[model samples]
Target: IVTVAGNVERPRNFEVRFGTPMRDVIVLAGAKPDTDRIIMGGPMMGYAMPGDEVPVVKATNCILVGSPTLFPPPPPEMPCIRCGECAKACPVDLQPFEMYWFSRAKIFGKAQEYHLFDCIECGCCAFVCPSRIPLVDYYRFAKSEIWAREQEKEAADTARERYEFRLAREEREKAEKAAKLAAKAAETKAKLAQQEAAKAAEGTAAPTPTAGDDAKKALIAAAMERAKQQAAAPLNTENLTPDQQAQIADAEARRAQALPAEGKE
Candidate 1:
């Protein structure tokens, strides 16, 4: 509902259709020929439109027609004299001047310390300001900047967590691969020891390649092949850092030492 008042002949409420030109709505209410500007909403909280030719949106609740006598330009802003009238006028009991000083300076953290969010943007502080400072606009700006900073912080935090997780997963995979290779080497060494002991007890200086001996050799060969493959890269090591290269080299060195001993035996 559009509350059509000021400079119109029949000032009353009208169910103005959405998307209709505000000028049409004013004409419907019988606007005076000398109407200077159109303001949406009440005098204190409302803003003046440059022209009434703009189409009205759902937010256009009150259409107050303005003339030179009705709505004169606000006086030049005077310096804050700290009269403290705005504090008394504030329904929320806020220090409007303090918040205004911090917000105007873009020191948003200081504005927050003054409980800036508690402001309902009702424009009461601006209405009573002896300095004629647009206090609510400053508070709104501070709130918007605070919101933007919070979003940036949240995004940065998320990116850091993802990077840390990737690094941890890579290190974990490398450790797992190294452990498997170590276990396999230990098992192969134990089997070789058992074979040597059995042959020494049988009094064979050199064991002939019997079918059973060939089967045992094949088993050892298969285990060694598996250990070699495990020591190979488990995943792509592309673009690895120097630290990663050092870790991979150490694992390969451990495997190399184990395999050489087994091969000599």
Candidate 2:
């Protein structure tokens, strides 16, 4: 069984295809194995596995064999002389030099202001730098910090949204209660008005005798006069025993004597 990942037949293994280099089989399947330059795996995270003679293993995914014409050699490294050339080549417009200085000094917060996380590691800054600096490494550290900050911001935003929603709900509930109270007051007022209207309507529908009305009015007046007399009865203590009545009369006489004479005035 000959297994081909990109092309050709499947079931290709060491047991199926004996004494044959895996590169040749891959080449036969329209894959260029003897390319001049090739990244073994992903460019950002993968390492170059040395030697073309290395046999294929199970861990092998895509053997990214490239050409020298396609992929050029990295620029030669030079000493970093505090030059600002890397800062100018930066596309995110971050001051790579300042960031490098701050990061080297362990002042992470100071480096963050320069938006160090925005660097895409395109090698443009490194390419233009007369003093070769690994700007990407510093950017990676900054990027991690920025990612952490983003998570914190997202959590805070969620909390804020929940608080706002709760406040709005409480306000809505309060308004509903006030509205219900107002509606109940209005209903009570309407009921009172309706009762008054009904009473007036009934009075108009059934006219009572004027004689009975006059008798009721007279009885009410008599009852009011009796109440008033009871209230004013203290002015005359004549109903008391003789000794008490005499004392009251003496007191009144003394009050009359103490009063100013009307005729003299």
Candidate 1 lDDT over 191-214, as tens digits, reads 999999987888956556799988
Whose TM-score is greatest here? 1
Model 2 Cα lDDT, one tens digit per residue, 1-265: 3443322233133232343455665555554443564343344433355655555565554445555544556566666786778777777787888887777666777877766666666767766777656566666666677677889999999999999999999999999999999999999999999999999999889676799899999999999999998997775534788899788899999888777675467
Question: Candidate 1 — which residues are off by over 4 angstroms?
Answer: 50-53, 151-265
TM agreement with the true structure for every prediction: 0.56, 0.40
- Please tell me which predicted candidate would have the highest lDDT against the true structure: 1
TM-score, cand. 1 vs. native? 0.56
Candidate 2 segments exceeding 4 Å error? 1-95, 104-118, 122-135, 200-265
Whole-model alpha-carbon lDDT for candidate 2: 0.66
lDDT scores in order? 0.90, 0.66
Span of 10 residues, lowest total lDDT, candidate 1: 200-209
